[model samples]
Target: MYVSLNRNTSKWVVKKFEENHNHVLHLPEHSHLLKSHRMVSEAQAINIDIAADIGLSLKASHDLLSAQAGGKECLGFTREDQKNYLRTRRQRSLKFGESGALLGYFRNQAAQNPYFYYAVQLDKEDMITNIFWADHEMITDYALFGDSISFDTTFRTNKEYRPFALFAGFNHFRMTCIFGAALLYDETVESFEWLFKTFLHAMSGKKPITKGKRMQDNGTLIEPLNQTTEHLLSPKYSRSIIRID
Candidate 1:
């Protein structure tokens, strides 16, 4: 196709239009791969966000959507496209800096639900060293099933390489219930101490009768666990055990 500017009429006119293709055209089955045909719809975008929030990998989310849509050919977008979308969305979210955005999100949550609780631990330089949060559901769950709990912090899968900690327990039916969660800058004893203290405060000073935690060979968590046990139990409840796995 070709167009020319017509100075007399100040309008563009088609000078040449070729009806025949110069090269082999894409087959119908492959047409969906074309740039013009590829797009992530609003509904699909929402599903992607849901999947990401639930910790689904890009490939897994894409495959699930593909299956839902009957097949990849009908999914309207590629996995790379989904990844690019998430990358751009994350970049946009950090426009005000990651810490600012995180605090803003927490503020919004607290505004919507008074039971939402969160705490940020800072260093001498006033930079965030760790963060902990638990919603109303988690708080209520803790009150009901906080007798025995497990804490884990081995996850460091995000881009920042921060340790993601989760405080969880089982309900009466043996279903897992989350009491709280945190992101730590390091695995040091100080970080764990602050996290445990904040968690106890958030749960209204309710202590688990039996606490379970994974043991790290570095021995950094030993001091924190010992200190936490002293504060977590009364003289009569001293039999509470700190199970190490």
Candidate 2:
């Protein structure tokens, strides 16, 4: 999914080392920092909300995401662009060895700058969803009066391999996702359709906060979910919606 939430959340497991004199005997040589060269889900020993409380800024990033172009609920991806991006990433993944050192290096950067976050939530049935966030855009962009935001979402083929992400776009800036539906990724799109439909269905089930019974007749409601695309090199937040427990 590789939805670069933020530099910290991405490498939270152990990028560098900072220690106190706990004096707990036998702390391993690499104990203070991350050791494994493996990719892990966001839920691996980290809590998104707690990480936010400690100044890890995923929520802020999510907020900075633009809903300016949000019009309809599900503006899916253009097949050509998406197919190409994945093909390119896949080619790169193969060259570098899907699970190799380059990836590990990205996993251990230790600078404190404005970064983003993608939270992964789970349920008793162990279903999962992802949320993309950034502290805020590094730049300030204003929408003109009467400017509208286009909310768009894109679903790709099932994860036949390791790389799987859900993408949302605002305009030029897009959020690349890494987590959603958890193990649902393992299933073919045909089989896991129930999950995909459920997400699309989220927009179909909005609880109208203002108009009473306006959406009752259809028994369905949807809100615009805009994906803001930016020019900065900030990472993508194209994952699934954040489904809370």
lDDT by residue (1-245, candidate 1, tens digit) is: 89999999999999999999899999999988998999999999999999987888889999999999999999999898998788556544433356567788999999999999999886554556677899999999999998877677656746544578788878999998999988776677677678887898999988776634334424533444443543222112223223221
Off by over 4 Å in 1: 1-97, 211-217, 224-245
Maximum-lDDT candidate: 1
TM-score of each: 0.52, 0.22
**What number of backbone clashes does candidate 1 have, counting pairs of residues 3 or more apart or in separate chains?**
0
Candidate 1 yields a Cα-based lDDT of 0.75
Give the CA lDDT, 0 to 100, for residue 241 in model 2: 23
**For model 1, which pairs clash?**
none
Give the deviation of candidate 1 from the true structure as CA RMSD. 14.2
Give the Å error, residue 80, model 2.
34
Candidate 2 lDDT: 0.28
Per-residue lDDT of candidate 2, residues 1-245 (tens digit): 12233566664344455565556654454332322422222342233234333554433322322131141111122223233333444444433553334334323421343332222233344333222222223111111110112111333332324323332223234332222222222223332234333333332322212111111112222222322211111123332222210
In order of listing, the candidates' clash counts read 0, 33
